[model samples]
Target: MEDFLVNINGTLLKGPEAKISVFDRGFLYGDSVYEATRTFNKRPFRIDQHIDRLFLSAEKISLEPTYSKEVILSEVLKTIEAAPFKDATIRIVLTRGTNSDLGLDPALSGPNNLVVFTKEIKPNPAWWITDGVSMIFFQKKIEASGSLPKTGNYQENILANREATSRGAYDSFMINTHGHVTEGTTSNAWVIKNNILFTPPLADGVLDGLTRKALLEMAKRQMLPLPLVEKSLTKDDFLSADECFITSTTRNVVPVTKIESHLIGNGKPGALTLKLLELYLEFVK
Candidate 1:
């Protein structure tokens, strides 16, 4: 079994053998929509939602996919199945194909190029979950609007994460121009105050993360005492919260112990955050 696999259009190839044209808009202008789905117990988790979001992203960017959603889904499953790992990450990318002319106009583009690949899942450091991760406030602004689709453009996030790492932090929480804490570099940010869950609203331009959606659903069905409120949050709010956490596809729910110099609560994963993580794990099972 191969450690990695790539499916270009309908052809499967080893990861090192996979290739795309340099003239492809996805490489040149980041003109692409993509989705990342991870497997649990050798089976895909929330694959339908991921694929749906992929189509939604394509629609938002006005980039028509070369294949139907069903076809894309089938291709993703096929690639994952061909991978060697018991648990893996599957990435589906749809890029505007190479243009006849070296121009920025979409009209010059050809058919979309669909690429699906699978790789081994990399878990977060044990300390990240056991002791919680330290985060810093990234003052730099992200150029992409939160409402935009999950496209190939990620320069801003890359820079933010780099800055965070340089500053000796696990990740960075980006603040908008208005001083509102939008989100983490790649995850959805959340804070618990007085037992109430607070996160930036989608209206604030934050991506509608699937993990965030799942958490909200779980919270509602479990009927938590306080309702999970979606509101515009500021850095001060996060720093002063009783507990803090972030959610993503790979890292489901991780506690945030410190933000900058301030220690959140007791500086360890709070009870509520741990409880929620337990519930989330059970939900995943």
Candidate 2:
């Protein structure tokens, strides 16, 4: 693909040149909060919402932003303007700075903020939506005392996704120790049956995704009944699902056709998923 420019700590660098220090806790300890947003028609989409989520994530993780929201937005726009591709994904990350040689200082300096660094995320393929995709359950269980959802503590997801890929799957469903399907590696999971929408609750340890929240709001505005059943899901629950889909900032909404070896209803994108995707695109536009 084409190269892009990235602005980090007030410096503009090419995609390959953009780099962060290894000493940064975000790198060393995975102690950081991040948000991802995409562009539509070459313009940043829902930028304000994305920035709000970034700040919210930082707050949830007890990490303070090094710059104000306005400044961060300005920097992101600057980076986008410098990129080669007009339409692309933008990522904002904030990390805990180094603790220094003195070691373990709770009173350490404020967070080290890092801006854009040239990232791109294409939408799912046409077939992925029209035909839908299959999902496999990972062997690992979500941790009880997990890091804040905002933080980049995705070690469990990394492993699970790797396992899923090896198993010839499109996505991995992470089950909590209590047997609840929390979420996917990088997307929020949803299942529909008999016209009722069901997704794991935050109590199940799923990230409060912005896309998920927006879709839920849209459904409410349109007088759609969303009975959010935050209960555990079994393999049978997926097989019995009339429709299933995943949501994220980049993917928006993609259909899930199968769970493990069991095929969802008709092995085609469900009507509910199709409606959600159409509504979501209209909402975005």
Candidate 3:
């Protein structure tokens, strides 16, 4: 319900005042990477892992931030302190800075730009967690190389998600070129079959998500006979699933009540899905 602070190169500015150049490669060529996390009770959850992944993304794109990890974390904490929400979504971005010429080369002549900001997050709708959500399938364009993961080139996901929501779904279940089920537009997908949890592996061109790792760890701590496994998946795998769910920093473990025309597990949230949500609530607390 309030404006939050923004951190650009260590300077704290009002969210609206923080600005970057149009010539910045992030604007020019989509040469940027970002990480996001949501807070619980004003405390950002597993932000370190998010920052670590941000670094990994930078490395993948050959971006070397002049700021150290500690400095960036400190700036993020400052912005969180300025946010007035019980729950906030914090995002950090690194971009190739402005240069004399517009080019795709990484050897630009400007200092890399960093942006950190927090926004008030509304409470997740109870129905989203209880009754669950629906999704449609999005096939890749076939011409796009599409191997980029965790980068800022989100036009495809934006378009697919817009189309899916317009068609009465919350998001789209994306399919890679190999006909493998990859993930949701903004989440990592998982399914339960015969009481075992299954998800796509990183080799299937999915983002290595932090919440997914936490869930796997939580599963390991389960003495309740729950098993978690990662493997390649397809539309058939999801359509035949006993239960389906997705994980992200913001939407932790949201059950999938349906996928396209197929009703997942009687068109209701599954028992294991609810249990995992409880586990996640406790884990975050």
Candidate 4:
């Protein structure tokens, strides 16, 4: 078994041997949609939801997938099985495919290419959840589209993340043009105040993250101590909140101890945030 496996359009290859054409629109113009999901004890978590979102993302960008959902899921499982890892992070990418003419028109592109890469999952630092991580507000406004797909075009996010890291922060929190806190570079933002949780609604141009969805569902089922509210939040609201946290597939629920210079809830992981993380892990199990 290999350390990692890459399955390109049904043909599996070693990680180092896997390659795609330079003419592929995904590489040339960043015309592609992708989903990243991780396994819990070798079993994929919420794989169906991930596949559903992947197709939706492709549809939003008008990029038709050559293979059906069943086929994609099958390939993901097959690749995971071929890899030697107790747990893995799976990334499924669907590119607009190759174009010999080097044109921007979708009609010029050939069949879409599907690529699945499965590799060992790298656990986050313990202090990230124990002591908590810090974040900085990204100056640039998020993309205006609320229904934006998880496409290959991530230059904005990449730059924001870079700026945050350079500034000694864990991640960058992005605000939309309306001054509403949308989300982090690759995670959904949440704030708790007076025991009530608040997060920017999908209307605020935030991605419909699966982890965020799971948290919301937990709140709906009364599993959380605080009632979750989907509302637009500004920087002021976040800075003054009693607790703050970010969620993603790989990171799960991690507390944010500070944003820029302002300390969040005593400059440590809040009790509610820890509880939420505990609940999330139980939910995952």
Candidate 5:
């Protein structure tokens, strides 16, 4: 814990030494944008893409970052270098700065603030990659945001995940108010059937995950006969799926062998799922 590194406004400090103002809009209101970048062999993987998404999210929320892109990239590298672990999970947070009053007005807000934190990356169990995971679905419509803004205001996911926990599942799927399959509590969902990979389009309010994008590219480059389709998905589609999985920055490709009462494809990690995962890992390295 003492070796953990944190960068607050370009100042490298210990995690315990880092602090932010209470009046910061990120604290008072959910006025912030963030990106989670993971490392492979101690180097950031696809960091450019993550930075692009971070800037996009900040633009969407009108949160101006004090540090330019170059500063961000350099500072992030420095923070990563300060970490003792060979692999890490790097999180960059840009807040709307602090304010004197509690008003929602941006003009009243102070200058933007940036925080970069690094911690040792913990690998998921070997069984998780082989046996996969189980999940439950809950219905709740969220209007799709194309860039997939992963903001601090993710209370919906928190509640949905709690629902999954009560049901003894690792994660849960959220169906939007429009009665469509949106995504997982914190990941993008994919259904593999008949050798085709199907997932919700960006219009469905699904986060355009960096890992998901990379996997799609890997699928194409490898010329794996499987076709990647981005379309609206439903419970019925999953109920008949041969295999299902979720993708995220930290978790990578996680097989979803079970959903609610239905068993997916003999209730095991499908062959194709494992193959794609192998290819994905190679791509990251």
Candidate 6:
């Protein structure tokens, strides 16, 4: 069994001992905001960006953080120092705390903060990178229109991702009610078409990912001449894309060689996908 260090409130606990009340609104009602980050060569990548996003998510969900950004940042460093794994992923979860039995009102909920010890990222698979993964178009749409911000209501993702796995797919591409391919179950979607990178607009209801932001910057720096196009995409458009990939904290960049039965550009990772992955890795290192 592996050991882990967990922080509940401000106290650190060994694996198997960390606990929160069952009445926590976050657990009972999914009223929580969270962030995931990976370390490169034992150093956290984009720590500031991740923390900033965490705060933004918490604010969106109305969770009052008891600690300031400086405090949380220090805590994250402490967690890394105590961890056994040199290279690891860090998960910071902030719950809306426990609600008074009087009612389920978030207004009365207390704060529930937890930091978990993490380890080496278990990237999808070698084949996922070399041969690329496949995606299934889920009939389900990621939360469409009218922004929910960061309510942490992830049930849709839970159900859709489970469906994807049950169907033997690596991930699911969640379309919106408007029929635009928005994002993946846990990653942001990007498509390469006619040598340009295209992704669903923020209006399409996808989480603005840190890696996505970085990629956009890289594209600008290289003067790639390729536009980071943002527009609604239909299933047919995705099927015909020259290449497709998803980005997130874990899978830095993973190509999608197929969508359902439609083969993605010769059924292999595209040249642009490889270049982007290399550039991203170099940026971190």
**Candidate closest to the true structure, highest TM-score:** 4
Candidate 1, residues 155-253, lDDT tens digits: the string is 777888998899899999988777788889889999999989999987777888999999889777974545698999998999999999999988889
What are the per-residue Cα lDDT tens digits for candidate 2 across 1-285? 126567877788876777777667776677887877887756888888888878887787777777888988888888777766656888777776655543445355445757575555565788987788888987555465332356778889899898888889988988877776778889988899887788777777777787888877776676344554545576567668898888988888989998889889999998778877887888876
Worst 10 residues of 2 by lDDT: 101-110
Candidate 6 achieves a global lDDT of 0.79
Off by over 4 Å in 2: 102-111, 119-123, 145-148, 223-232
Ranking by lDDT: 4, 1, 5, 3, 6, 2
Best candidate, lDDT = 4
Residues 1-285 of candidate 3 have per-residue lDDT tens digits of: 137667888787876787888888888878888988988888888988888888888888788877778988888888788667768888888886776787777776488788887878776789987789999999966433323446677887898799899999999988888898888888999999998999898877778888888887777787324798988899999999999999998878899999998899889999988888888878875
**CA lDDT of every candidate:** 0.86, 0.76, 0.83, 0.90, 0.84, 0.79
Q: How many residue-pair clashes does candidate 5 contain? A: 4
Q: List the lowest-lDDT window of 10 residues for candidate 6.
A: 141-150
Better of 3 and 5 by TM-score: 5
- Native-to-model Cα distance after best TM-score fit, residue 26 in candidate 4, in Å: 0.3
Error of 5 at 86 (Å): 1.3
Candidate 5's error at 146, in angstroms? 3.2
Q: Which residue window of length 10 is worst by lDDT in model 5?
A: 139-148
lDDT of 3: 0.83
Better lDDT candidate (1, 2): 1
Better of 2 and 6 by TM-score: 6
How high is each candidate's TM-score?
0.94, 0.89, 0.93, 0.97, 0.95, 0.92
Query: For residue 214, what is the lDDT in candidate 1?
Result: 90
Q: Tens digits of per-residue lDDT for model 4 on 252-275?
A: 999999999999989999999999
> Every model's Cα RMSD, please?
1.9, 2.6, 2.2, 1.5, 1.6, 2.0
Candidate 5, residue 8: lDDT: 89
Clashing pairs in 3: none
